[model samples]
Target: MPDFQKIPSNDVIDTLLKRVSVRKFTDEQISDETLDLILKTSFRAPTSSNIQAYSVVVVRDQEKLDALAAASGGQRHVAQAPVFLAFCADISRIEDALVRNGHSIDSNNLETGLVSAIDAALVGMSAYLVADSLGIKGVMIGGARNKPHEVAHILGLPQRVFCVFGMSLGWPAEAPAQKPRMDYDGLVHFEQYGKSRSGADAKKVVDDYDVALAEHYRGQGRQTTDASWSDDMDKKFHPWLRDDLRERLKELGFDFR
Candidate 1:
């Protein structure tokens, strides 16, 4: 286990800086009170017009969790975590309300879709922060979109309520090493977008990161062979290996138009 010093002040900036994604979890259950607090924290996130166009489905049933695991590309963490939450971009509630008030809303509108997705992401980030504050570990499972339709069916989500992602929370079995980030000078600009660095310079930085990551994983007893971040990213970028989430989103009533 890695020793992490507690930040006494509990300042939001310090808390955010210390948070890391935890994939491996211990065999322990999260208490109902903790779960409630996490959900309530999520609900407090700022929303566009306070529409709060999002909802969460908590998966506790073993069979349902198993199905979700399958939908999430067989990530065992989905089933192993004490709490599995599917954060949704929900336009359905707003549409229903509009109908009841004698106004019709189109689910295909670009603005509506964007707002729902924004709400879901904000709420999910809040949940992660809350979990970290309580010493609980979590991982965001973007892999849940590998089979979005199947995930929606499993969760019994209504039309216009799409699964944006899933989050798994529990006590971590081990602490993961801090992943290296790109140099701030390379990423951040004062006002406008900056000119790109030379390819050689970029490659050198990425190669260094690859070495750092491989060593970090090796220290944790995980196997990895890529000598650079670019190599691993290239392997993951194949079109065939990627899921057609855009089409899935369209089917869930989001309009790219």
Candidate 2:
């Protein structure tokens, strides 16, 4: 059996450490007040230079959700979700601020885009954690980028404002098992960067993890091979993702220079 002793003792910390995305949710409606409170409270998330480079567009309208669902490669959860929020990395707002103050930035730089996206991601996770505290379950929608231009067009996103990702939030209808992560020691590093201490070290970690994961799949009644993780990674990266990503970002004013 997997070790549960490694989990945190604090409830909040444990909650964060064990978080798994919930795609299946009930039809229960979330209160406007609770949503507002979460947004307001989680705005305390740190931002690069305090620029606060994120904005969220909440979609509750069925038509818009359905369009989003189609845009996300038929992710029906987006439509069925009680609330969907498009978290945008908004350099447009910062650019406006700097221009009004007689300062202009070359927003075409990749660092600008990176910071904006990082800011959006930080706040999005903060929002998710806050919602989780209230027993709300949700999942992030990276698939929204599969047809990003349409997503931006549907939401009327302005230049220098793009969806880094989205979120579908509601009460969960099913509780899924917590997925295994890489071994704690395998991931954490100290006293400068280090590789596996010996040639066999790498294989040992991989082989052990493969067994753990394959066993996990079997427990879930999933038919998977021992190399499931590597196989999935190979499938994911053999073809580069989102061929139009650069052009789409360019059209949105992120030239990435």
Candidate 3:
């Protein structure tokens, strides 16, 4: 039998365990050499069929960062961070390469979009992990998608490309308490979803989590409700947040139709 307890700890493992989203940072900027090393190392992450259908736009200009901050719904962290990395799902390069071979991405479909987005997500995560290991902390800005069209315009991205997400990186000035996560059994399943994994089972997990999260909020001197997590999720997800996203993505040349 394998002895899981005997597994030795390593730097990467420690980094993963200690990972937290950092929004505030000191005045220090990430050195160009260090940024290059992080990006190059992260690009080594697995790509689908080696297509490498992703691109990263490094923004250091205060004006552009400010524009991006507005594009992402006025996220001050985006504007304040020393660097903002926009990880993009880009098919334009692939299309260009295909044209050289007498073909084009004319038949792009949902699968194609999904593959490219997944590729960008993988590389983005790899970059974050690399940065975290080096004591640089940051947060993933999914709000970059809140206004995809504006993001493309700000980044000067071509039609067949979109910012899947953005990341802000810098030296930390504050360490916010790490939030608790959902129960493991609720998220991880063996063989298949458990036989009792129905609405009640799921709700039980969430219900327990609600109480735990309420306590967590109280500990942080923040207000909380009885159903803290669920209430917040409902508030954010209700009314179908970002109703214009599908059309915006279509305008950006992502074919989900």
> How does each model score on lDDT?
0.82, 0.86, 0.92
User: What ranges in model 3 sit over 4 Å off?
Assistant: 1-3, 195-200
Give the clashing residue pairs of candidate 1, or none.
Answer: none
**lDDT winner, 1 or 3:** 3
Clash count, one per candidate:
0, 0, 0
lDDT of 3: 0.92
Candidates 1 and 3: which is better by TM-score?
Answer: 3
Error of 2 at 69 (Å): 1.2
What stretches of model 1 exceed 4 Å from their correct place?
1-9, 101-103, 195-208, 221-227, 240-243
Clashing pairs in 2: none
Decoy 3 TM-score against native: 0.94
Worst 10 residues of 1 by lDDT: 193-202
Best by TM-score: 3
Top-scoring candidate (lDDT): 3
